[model samples]
Target chain A: MNEYKRISPSKRFLINIVLVIIFIVVGTLLTGGDSLSRASRALILQIGIYVILAVSLNIATGYLGQLPLGHAGFMAVGAYSAALFWKATLNMPTPVSIVLGLIIAGLIAAVFGIIIGIPALRLKGDYLAIITLGFGEIIRIAIINLSGITGGTPGLLNVPKYSSFLVVFLCVAATIAAIHFIMHSRHGRAILSIRENEIAADSCGVNLTYYKVLAFAMSAFFAGIAGALYAGFQGSLFPKSFDFMASINILVMVVLGGMGSMLGSVIAATVLTALPLVLQALAAYRMVIYSILLIIVMIFKPSGLLGRYDFSLPGLIEKWMNRKNKPGKEVANE
Target chain B: MVFLQQLINGLQLGSIYALIALGYSMVYGIILLLNFAHGDIIMVGGYIVLLIIAAGISPAVAIAACIIGCIVLACVIEKVAYTPLRSAPRISLLITAIGVSFFLENVAQLLWGADPRVFPATRIIPATSYQIGRLTISLTTIVTLVVAIAAMVVLMLLVQKSKMGKAMRAVSEDMGAAQLMGINLNRIITFTFAVGACLAAIGAILYCCKYPQVKPTTGYILGIKAFVAAVLGGIGSIPGAVLGGIAIGLAEVAVNALGYSTWTDAVVFVILIIVLLVKPTGFMGASMNEKV
Candidate 1:
C-alpha cells in the first residue's frame, strides 16, 4: 500500500488492466443466463451505449468547450456503415463480423468528423453550435434522399445482432478509460486548456488547431463505436433514428449528467434511460415531467447533481441509505 | 421560365429566412446571446396559428392573434430563460437556451402528440396566377415577397431613424456604456424579442399558406437555417440578416435546380464555411472588438 507515489506512469497500465477486467466481469454477470435475464441484459447494453455517447460527446462539448448538437449524424454514419459491413460478413465468424463493422464505422465517422471539425472550429459560441447542427441535418437529408445506397426511407435492417452486453460494455469502458487517460495526459490537459481559455492555451504554445482536431476525432471515433454497437444491437434503425431530435436527447442526457464528469454522464444516462420504464404508469406525462424536471434542475443545480463529480460507491451509499426508496425505476419495473 | 420561377420561389422563401434572422441578429447585437430558442418560438407561433385556424377563425384574425401570441411567448422566454442567466457567462446562457429549445419541442409533442397535423387550408392571399413575359407568379408568392420586403424596410427605419434604434445600436455596440447612458436593458431586450417573434408570426402564417401543413416541430430546422443566414450576413448587423437570408434562399433554389437539393444543408454550410474561412465578420459585419 506504500505504492501511491512509487507507482510510475508505466505501472499505470496495471490499473487500466484491472479496470478493464472489472468492466467485463460485471457486464457478463449482468447479462448472463437465459429466459428472464433478458431485461437486465438490455438495460446493460443501453447503459453501455449511453456511456459511449456521453464520453465521446464529452470531448467536443465538455472537454473542448464546443457545443455540437448534431452528433447523431456521426452515429448514423457508423450505424449504416457497420450494418452494411455486417450484412456482407454474415458468413464470417461472429468476432470477425463485429470487428469489421466497428472498423468500417469508426473510419468513416472519423473522416467526416475531420471535415466538419476543421471548418467549424474557426468560430465559437453559437456559431459552432449551429454549424454542427447544419451538418447533422445535411447528413440525415443525404441519407434520406440517397435511397439507392442507404435504402431511402426504409433504413438497412436485419443487421447481425452480435452486440452482446459484454461487447457493448467493453467498448464503452474502453472509451471512458481512453478518454480519462487522454484527459490526464499532456494532450488531454491541452484539450482542457482549450476549453477553459482558447486564447491562453494558444499563448501557452498549445497548437489549438491540432488539439481541436484531435479532440473532435476522438469524439467521433467513440461515437462511431457506439453507433456500430447500436446497429448490431437494434437489428434495424431507420434514417429517422439519427434525426436532430435524437441528437438533442443524447445532448440532454450528457448535459443533465453534468459535463466533463464521466461519472455524472453514467449516472445521468442510467437514470434518464431507466426513468421511463420505472414510471410507466405516468407514461402519458413522461416528457412534461421530464421538461419540468430539467427546468427545475437548471434553476437550482444548473451544473447538475454531480457536476464534474465522479460516481464512486461511497457517494451512492451516502445518498441511497439516507433517502427513501427512490422516485422510480427498479427491477420490478423492468 | 423554369429558372425565373425558381428564382421567385427562392426570393419568397428567402424573405421568410430574413424575417427569422432579424431576431438572431438583434439579440446577438444587443445582448450577445444567440438565443437558440428563437427557432422553437417560431414553432410555437406555428402551433398557435394552427389552433386559431382550427377554431374556424378568419385568416386575418388568426394572423393577428398569432402575432400577439408569439409576442407573449417571446417575452416569456426572455424573462424566464434569458433574464435570469443575465449575469452568467455567454456559454451558460446559450446552454440554457438550448435546454429551453429542447424543452419546448418535447413539451409540444407531449401535449399534442408527435403527429404532424394539417393546418386549416385557407389562402391568406388570393390564389390567382398571372403571367407576363413568359414568367408566372401566384398571388401568394407575390404577396409574401412584397410583405417581406415591406417588413425589412420598416425594420431598417426602426433601427436607423428612431431613438430606440439609437439605444439598441448603442447597446449592441457596448452594453456597459449603454447602461451608463441610462437606457433600459430589460425593456430593449423584451422589445427585441417581441419584434423578432412578431416577424416570425407573419412568416409562420405565410409558411402555412404556402405549404398548407403545420407540424409541431416545423420550426427547428428552419430556425437553424435562419440563424445560419444571420451568421452569413454578419450577426448584429440588420442589413446583413436580410442579405444573408436572400442569399440562402437563392442558394437553396439554385442548389435544387442544379440537382443537389439533397445537399441543401451541406451546400449552405459549405458556402458558410467558405465565408467564415475567408471573412468571419460575414457579408456586412465588421469585426467586433470586445473590451475585455
Candidate 2:
C-alpha cells in the first residue's frame, strides 16, 4: 500500500506550506514591500477574487464533472446583495460588513443554485449548459431592467473601497482551505463517483440528484462569498461587470487548470489573473489570444495543463530527472 | 389600439425569433451541441449585407449575396472550431463554440466599434395599420409571419421527406453507424451549419426591419432569448422551437403591457427555471438512453 500510494500526506501538506511561503515572498516583492499602491493592491485583490471564483467553479465543472456557464449570474447575486447590505449597514466595520455580505450573498445564491440545479441536473451534456447560459443572461438583463434598485445600465459606483490586502488574502485562504476540506471528505468521494459514472454510482446507492444539487449549491455559496469580497474590493458595481463574459472567464480558468484538480485551479487562477498585466504588450488582443489559446488547450490537452496532477516542488524535481534519464524505457509500441 | 399595436409588434418579433430558433433546434435535434456562436454568425451576416449594400447594390441583391456569405462563414467556423473536436466529449465542443463566439464578437468590435448603426429601412413598412374589430394588423406583421411559417413548413418537409434529409437525420442519430452505412459526416455537419446560418440571415433581416438598429453586441441578448425559445419548444424538435419563440414573444409583449418591462429578462428566466423544474426534458426535448 505504501509503495502504491507513492506520496505521503505529511509530505504533501509540507509541500503546500512551502508553496504558500514562496507565493507570499514573491507577492511582497512584486508589491514593492507595500500592498497599498493602487495598481499593486488591485492586482493582489484580483488574484484573491479569482482564486475564490476558480476554486468554487472547480466543484461544478471540475469535481462534479458538470459544465456550468452561469457562475457569473450567481456572482452578480452576491455583488448586488453585498452592495445592498453594505449600504444598509454603513456603520459596520470593514471585516463585519464583509462577513455579513458574504453570508447574505451565499444564502441568496444557494437558493438560486437549488432552483437551477433541480431541472438542469437531470439533463446531460450541453442541454444543462444551455440552461446555465440562459440563467446567466437572465441575471444580467434583470439587473439592467430593475434600474430602480440596481441602477440599471448606469451601474452602482463609489462603493467605498474599504477592502485591504489582509482581508482579501484571509478570505481567499479560508475559501481554499474550505475547498480542500470538502475535497478530502466523503462528499468528495460521492462527487467523483457521480462524475465517473452516474448510473453506476446510482446503482451503488449514491443519490445522483442530491449530489448534483449539493455540488451546485456549494459552488454557488462560495461564488457568492467571492462576489461579496469583490464588491468590497472594487468599491463599485455594475451589472455589466458580472456579465456572461465573467462566467466564461471563470470557466476558462477552471478548464485551463486540470479539471478536478484543486492545486491546478489555484495556480491557473493566479497566472491568468496576472497574465494580462504581465504581458501588457498585446493588451488589446487579450480576448483573441485567450480565446485561441483556450481552443488550442481544448484540442491538445483536454485534460488541461496539469492533467489531474498537483504541483510539488521536491517531488517534481526528483521525478523530473529520473523520468527523462530512464536507462531503458519500458516503452511499448502504440 | 395599443393592444393591437403590441400584438403586431410581438408577431413580427416572434417570427424572427422563430426563424433563428428553428436552426438552433434543428442542429441541436441532430447533434446535442448548442453551437453558441450561431447567433454571432447571424451578426456577421448582417455585416455582410451592410457591406454589399454599401457596394452600390440593391437590398435584394445584397440579401442574396449575404446569404451565400453567411453559409460560407458558418461552414468555415464548423471546420475550424468544431471539426477537430468532434470525437472529444460534448462539453469540450460547447466551450469551443463559446470561444468561437467570443472570437467573432471581438472581431466585430474591432472593426465596427461599439456604436449602434441603423439598417437601411425602406418606406414599404406601413406607417399605420388596418383595424379588424378591436384588433389591428400591419403589413409587416403579415409578411413576417407569412415568410416564417412558409420557411418552417418547407424545412419540415425537407427534413422529414427528402433523401438528403434522410442522410442528415441518419448522421444526427448516430454518426458512427451512419458512417458505417456510407454517409459523409463532414458534409452533413457543414450543411447543417450553412442552413442554420442562412436561416439566421433571414432572422437578421427581420430583426433589422423591426428594430432598425444593429450593433456589435446586438446578438448577445437576442442570442439568449432565441436559445430560451429553442429550449422551450423542445430543443431538438423544429415545431417546438417555433412554438417556443412565439411563447417567449407573447410573454415579452405581456410583460411590457403589464408595465413591467423592467422584469422582462427576469420573467423569461423565471419561466425557464419553472419549465425546467416542471419538465427537465424541456417542452419537446427527448430522453435518449445512454449506453452504459
Q: B1-292 in candidate 1: lDDT tens per residue?
A: 8988899999988998999998888888888888777888877777787787677777778778889998998899889877877887565677778777777887788777778887664536667889988898888888889889899888888877799887777787878899999999888888888888888888877777677766657777788888889989998888888899999999998998999767787788778778887888898888553200
Poorly placed runs, candidate 2 (over 4 Å): A1-37, A145-151, A313-334, B1-4, B123-136, B284-292
> Alpha-carbon error at A79 in model 2, in Å?
2.3
Clashing pairs in 1: A147-A152
Question: Cα RMSDs of all predictions?
Answer: 6.6, 4.2
DockQ of 2: 0.61
Candidate 1 stretches with Cα past 4 Å from truth are A1-23, A290-292, A311-334, B121-123, B287-292
Name the lDDT value of residue A307 in candidate 2.
Answer: 67
lDDT string, candidate 2, B31-92, tens digits? 66787888887787777777677677877887887788888888888888788998898878
Predicted candidate 1: interface RMSD? 2.4
Candidate 2 residue lDDT tens string, A1-334 = 1111235667767776777767666665665565457776788789889988999999999888889999999989888888888888888886778777778988998888888888887687776887787788788888887788888898877675656666667677777877777877988889889988888999999999999999999999889888887888888888878888899899888888888888888888999899999899977777777788788888888888886786556577557646644545534311
Measured against the true chain A, the candidates' chain A TM-scores are: 0.87, 0.85
Best-performing candidate as measured by TM-score = 1
TM-score of chain B of each: 0.94, 0.92
Taking chain A of model 2 alone, its TM-score versus the true chain A equals 0.85
